[model samples]
Target chain A: MTDTTVKEPVQFFVTEDPHHHDGDHGEHHHETGTMLGFWIYLMSDCLIFGILFAVYAVLGGNYAAGPAPVDLFELDMILVSTFMLLFSSITYGFAVLRMDRNDLKGTLLWLVITGGFGVAFLYLEVLEFSHLIHLGATPQASAFLSSFFFLVGTHGMHVLGGSIWLVVLLIQLSQRGLTHENKRRVMCLSLFWHFLDLIWIGVFSLVYLTGVLL
Target chain B: MSDHAKGGHGSLKSYLIGFVLSVILTVIPFWVVMGEPLDNKGVAVAIIFILGGAQMLVHIHYFLHVTIKAEQGWQAMSMGLTILLLVIVLSGSIWVMFNLEENMMPAHEQIERVRNLP
Candidate 1:
């Protein structure tokens, strides 16, 4: 019995050390946790967007004789803005690739380009909104306009928040040079940026393209 | 450290593939709408929705890097649950509201009959 006990402790010692080392070296504990947490947050954000989409879907037909979607939505300009967002999504992907390679300068450059595209998207959106208001299709004009503005405006606000986060991350990256915390931040922001692009797919498809078609 | 870290992110080739697919997907819908090649509006709208959903899956795969293996499958699990809930919320609200509108709102003739009840 004593011999078996001694051998068992020896076996446990051998297995425990490698297992501990593997856990420490293979991945950072907090990094995985942070990523999972951020992902959960994004899923919750998705629910909010789902609600807004429902609101728009239900109320989109009540134009109150003010103006229909085709009359207000300029497909040409919207297509341009859609390209801006798609380009930004790719550029942000490039940035994440650069980060993976530890290419600091390349990552920053791609991020800057991504930011430029994001700004262009926002500018186009603001132009569209102002033009709509000028044309007297204000939110108060009809339930359709109200829901349209709310859904699309909420998406724009998310993009705006992401842009701000990107700027902050850029500054942090420049100062810290991709430390562990900065790397995690970059990864989270990457998720946010890409998620926004995903949401844009819905917006352009359902709100803009279908709106015009309807 | 970098090697293991790189596992989670996509390579340049993958990103390029996704970008190209996305561009094609996006362009087709815009073209269909602007060019009006499809005479049937319903068919055109269906095409737009299908392509848009395809593009969204592409983004989720390529950009988000979500997989059954990611985060020991927790990511995929959470995403699945969220999608289920999203579908329920969106479809439920539309269905209920549409039914409510249909049943509750009186027809013009019915309203006139009620007014003439005196």
Candidate 2:
């Protein structure tokens, strides 16, 4: 009976093998699954940001007799940081283009450049935050300050995470030399990086520009 | 499927177009706000929001490479759903909260009456 049961599965597998062809089938499934799974993750991340943005919109005007956005925000400084993130987005795009061409060195080069801009953006954010705190615009000062910090700080943390990922990816790509797996990793990070830039567009517009207008 | 398999990495021209469009979109808002080219605050705010929205679409198309054809249309579908949810969350919260603040808060006359009574 046991022999018959095992042989039954073996026959079924033999029939399926012709259609699946093991190697190509597995690779294709894995690739599509990874990409789709990553996209789903990004969508979920978008929701989280959406919630934070909602919080900011609700609480942003409650200065509690403290300094307001126009008092603390420096438009020129913010514009510089905005451009930093934008430049990083395009540079990361260049990295993916290089990867598609199988230019390992060029891919790594652009990735490093992207990382540089990311770091610069983070640095500017840190500077802005410190400047705010020094001027007594602490998050605890008011609802407005609290929500503002939470929203923009979250975006900054994402950039920091992406920067760390970029460094790790750089090491992996150098070691693996653009293997299919490494290429997949690059693509996922590309999505992540670009998605962050998209979020920043919302931040700069709603938080910085609109803050000044308010 | 072939194009999808390539992950729609976008071309040099596409990225450049996106970047240039983003710069233009971005500059106009900053210019409107900083330069105060428009006398009406309402118009300036409208320009900022409109331009910001436009730049976001550009980024999604060129940088992220999201399209109806990509990923068997799932990408675009998912994006549509997210945008719908976002609109509901944002507008709903503001509307509800604004009404709550308006209706729940005591009037100045009521506050003055309470203060005088005590």
Candidate 3:
């Protein structure tokens, strides 16, 4: 007869010791609640966008016998927009780096810069949509147009949301000076902002780049 | 004015390379595909899929620092999950909708019907 020993599984718990900003973080009891909560929000946001993308793919090619992606979608404009958004994403990384260095002013400045680029990206898209509608490719024209509006519109709304978040962060920076709450907010917003940039990549490819190719 | 210059868009060379690759990739497709009236819809669809995936990876890796180690495993896991949900929703619905569109109203003729409707 062989005897086997049973072992109990270990349970992990969260702690509240703040200010672990270094990358080489040791194992702590903290649960990263701010990060965890932000992730929940991100997942919910993903679902919202997932539904919209489903709509986009479903009606995507419905040209309605109107000016399709081939006729619309200028490569030059989209390239410019892509650069602006991508650059903004990079700059936000600068802000997080500054925050880690405890440079509040520099962090705030970078966040503002990131927000500015986000604004520019949104502007370019609005202009593009206006031009398309002017050329008689309104969302009401066909399923393709409708899907285009939903996919792009959902992204544009996120940019707008991030920009607004920046303004709030600016205020918090001025008044609070990187309090723990503010720190968590900044971190979460960084994730959201960067996630938006990632989605824009999908947008640029699926809607604009491929729209041109196919 | 920051400590971590190793982070995103940290240098001129990288930005230039990313920018150039993005431009060439985007522009060449426009020039190549737009010139020809394609007889094969299947080929066009395949091209679109390939281009879309490539350009998207370029944007995510270069622009957003959604690296494998940001916040331990959190960032990567969240990103992977988001992508999975996106693909499932987008591709699955597209397939279903196209079938319905084809069986319900037919192709270019249905489009004309939509266009001519008041």
Candidate 4:
């Protein structure tokens, strides 16, 4: 039939894939494109963190006569926090793997575990900061302290954000049983959790390690 | 399914390496700052500084996977720009501050307060 003669239009099939044509396997939802969009958002998040790291590096070592990284860091506790955050990132990876398998319960369990560890890490970090303040290393005291706060504080905030993300994913997983959207959300959270772990490494290296040396 | 194959030991192995490197980096720097003189070392702190930067790359590439993808090239470009700006701000300010200290501090009583200490 000629294109002009077709009454229903040439693109009348409603979707590119046969599985989605009748809306059976698709159940009126699509995720492939959405995942790409989330990936874009992840890239943008990279830029945000780039700016923060620059701020921290520039401000680092402006110690203004207060306690510096050398005097402030306690290697033991930071080592523990590092383990928690890194492990949480790995567990979140496992969670997403389970999600891909359609094991909703397993995914939820792993995500909750990841979130719990993340919260624990944040708690310890707050306590560490409190102790630092007690010893007179407040952010306002010096440029070095300011940079230290921004660097570590930004990581702490990302952990908090990841914890909230896992919580929401839990709610969705329970309510929807690993629907496509929920799975995509879990994958995105995994990337974000791992991203925070990556930042923690930089913190461990630049701020904690280098600060102590300087 | 791609999902079932996703769980593996490789990711965990990388994580462990990253952790150990992090610990070593932390310890050496801490020791140096706490008053072990680096004067006698043949290489000085130069080796440690290079190691630390390399360790940072390990975390970024192995864990983050951000790179020069066609779609995500902005991330790398932005990161490079940020690094350039960071170096300028940090080094320039530090240089200015050191010069300021030498030229200006002797003009004030702050120096006298310390000199008069019993």
Query: What's each prediction's TM-score?
Result: 0.88, 0.89, 0.71, 0.67
Full-model lDDT for every candidate: 0.85, 0.87, 0.69, 0.64
lDDT of 4 by residue, A34-110 (tens): 44455556556655665666666656756777777767898768778977986786677667656656687888888
lDDT of 4: 0.64
Residue A174 lDDT (model 1): 92
TM-score of chain B of 3: 0.68
Error of 1 at A126 (Å): 0.7
Worst 10 residues of 2 chain B by lDDT: B1-10
Better of 1 and 3 by TM-score: 1
Off by over 4 Å in 3: A1-31, B1-81, B105-118
What C-alpha lDDT, on a 0 to 100 scale, does residue B20 get in candidate 1?
94
Poorest lDDT segment (10 consecutive residues) of candidate 2 chain A: A12-21
- DockQ of all candidates, in order? 0.53, 0.49, 0.26, 0.17
- Name the runs in model 2 displaced over 4 angstroms: A1-25, B1-3, B109-118
Pairs of colliding residues, candidate 3: A15-A29
Among residues 3 or more apart in sequence or in different chains, the pairs in candidate 1 whose N, CA or C atoms overlap within 3 Å are none
Model 4 interface CAPRI class: incorrect
Clashes of each: 0, 0, 1, 1
Using DockQ as the measure, name the better of candidate 2 and candidate 3: 2
- Give the 10-residue window scoring lowest on summed lDDT in candidate 1 chain A: A12-21
Candidate 4 lDDT over B1-118, as tens digits, reads 1222133213546656655665565456545644556764434345455665675676566555446652235546655665676566556766776787677758658688879999
Off by over 4 Å in 4: A1-40, B1-62, B65-118
Candidate 1, residues B39-74, lDDT tens digits: the string is 899999999999999999999998888988887789
